[model samples]
Target: MEEFSPRILPLLWRRSVPARRAVGRPPRLSVDIVVTTAIRLADTEGLEAASMARVAAELSVATMSLYTYVPSRPELVDLMVDEVLWARGLTSDGTFRERVLLYAERTFAMYRAHPWLAEVPRARPPVGPGMLAEQEYVLAAVATLGLPVRELNRAAAGITTWVTSAARHEAESALLRRTTGLSSDEWWQQRGELWENWFDVGSHPTMTMIWNAGAFDRGADQQAQDAYEYGLGLLLAGIERSVEGDDRVP
Candidate 1:
């Protein structure tokens, strides 16, 4: 059996080996054109809809020609993710918390704009210029806290992890509602009778008390937004305390 090669790192880093000169007219397509077409396809439809054949059709080129620019679908998706990130660059202009909040807001908005982004598996993220720009922006903001290098890195990672996770969840939820033609609230409401029949107040006393108190009355969108803001506030508070050398932070 042959080992699989991603063949994406070089392309992402713009260090790909030059192709052999073909004995024909210069090719009309470039990597930028290919990636841009794929991104556009993924943005309107879902990521899965942007297959090589579809992209080639959009580009008016042969399907096999796309492979010459982007090795495979996985590589194209990686490129698409990085391109979107690059387009939504972060800013470091503001106070610590404000800057961090702006970063989170921008990231969330990006995910909302391109919901397919949440579907991409980024365990090994593309090391492209866009990814580096985002990392630098966050690290610079966190570095202002005057912590040691290790603590600074950890703080930056924590902020990024929290924001990305929250944004992904929000994006996925939106995509689900769009695809299923039913908002989360509507879906739950449809199951109201089932809940009324199966839910046992005695079994879940705390939940029953909350439900009776109107704690869950908010719409799903509002609830999700509120939860995101609340969690972000807590994260910001913890960072502030850590900077102040609060022993209770641990």
Candidate 2:
């Protein structure tokens, strides 16, 4: 067997894609044109629907023509995510909940609106301003804690990761639940009829109370709150703990 241990990789994965100030014959494509082309392709068709070739066609150019702009698929998607995210403006005036909630909801809405965007694998040293704005917003909310810049970075990253992961999980689980005619709720309800009855009233008193309460509403199903409030609240609470405890910034 041949041991092909390691290899060189494209700089796209290593360094930030350099910002281009020109488009067409001037030696670069306008970042807006490149990003907009990507967004239009992804939006009209789907994430999978957008490709360098397809985007070029959408732009009425040769497939090789796009190479003058985005270097690769990952780079293109990064551009598109950042481009589409620009619609979510950042506000600095709100309280902890308000500011943080704004970031979280914006992130969740973007990913939910483009489910495929949630699946991209990110690299260290984020490369887009839209994402950078999100981090800024999150840190601004926690600035009162007076944490070191590094700790603030961690808090902001937590908020970012929480929104992306939660939205992805929610979308996937909803799809799976729908595939089965009976949701997890219906399955759990039927569990009571099973012979082994793990949720029997005598064995599970708490569950019985929950079942009786009917907390799970199938139609008009609502989260305790939308993803923004839910995720933002969690991060704000975490910051509160850090502030109140020995975890103060160094």
Candidate 3:
């Protein structure tokens, strides 16, 4: 089998053509099966657990044979990420703000369900159909507003970025609690006692006041969600103001 290149990765993902196979014999594996198995491993364990060997083992195939469908573990992971994102439907009907918020909420839910996605390094944009579909969805929502091309791209990116950050926060916190066997409240309770003993509350009157106001009593999950919704509202409001101020926008 030939090595996969960045130029050809999109072709492979879009299924521009079926993968090369034997003439007289039916293939025993497929790219979808390989990616699905890898995703299962990652979802059940962690990203590191979805090694080529483990994925092949789970599929009951020779490790090298697995390469016939997926060129490398990185390629397989890329495919898995796209597959997960593709499964999520991102569409809604409402005002522009409402549509954007609905999409943000769905993206948040997806990341929470697949926390391993937070570990993936997206240094470059993904070109997979799934990712592009998501991009198209956002652009379609904002297209009627008549924003410039630059602002349109920025608006789409802003909403997704906000959701990704919020989702990562919640997912990381949950993972930490699972690893340490301590709930957020329990961990903070212990820290609270230590602060009472050695910390100088007088040094930070503003924080001290907020802390005393029962703000911390709200669970971390609730606080994270509240902050995300509040911030999203502010973000949408700013965008609306920009649209209204710029006569160029429709």
Q: Best candidate per lDDT, number? A: 1
Q: Which regions of candidate 3 deviate over 4 angstroms?
A: 1-4, 7-12, 16-22, 246-250
TM-score leader: 1
Supply the TM-score for candidate 1: 0.90
Cα misplacement distance, residue 95 of candidate 1 (Å) = 1.6
lDDT for 212 in candidate 1 is 89
Q: Estimated TM-score per prediction?
A: 0.90, 0.66, 0.87
Q: Candidate 3, TM-score vs. the true structure?
A: 0.87
Question: How should the candidates be ordered by TM-score, best one leading?
Answer: 1, 3, 2
**1-250 in candidate 1: lDDT tens per residue?**
6344657777786634666678889789988899988888877888888999999999999899889999888788888888888887676677888779888888998998899988887677787878888889888898787666777777888889989988998888888887998988898899899777998888999998988899789988778888888988888778777766554345
User: Which pairs of residues collide in candidate 2?
Assistant: 22-28
Lowest summed lDDT across 10 adjacent residues in model 2 is found at: 4-13
lDDT of 2 by residue, 1-250 (tens): 6332122122223235555566666744544676677777665556776788888887778888787656666667766666656568877687776776676677667665665564465544234566676667777877766666678878777776776667666544444454566655566576656735444678877766765787544332244235445666766776777777587634
In model 1, the runs with Cα more than 4 Å from the true position are 1-6, 15-26, 246-248
Ranking by lDDT: 1, 3, 2
Candidate 3, 86: how far from true, in Å? 1.4
Which clashing pairs does model 1 show?
none
Residue-level error in angstroms, candidate 1, position 237: 0.7
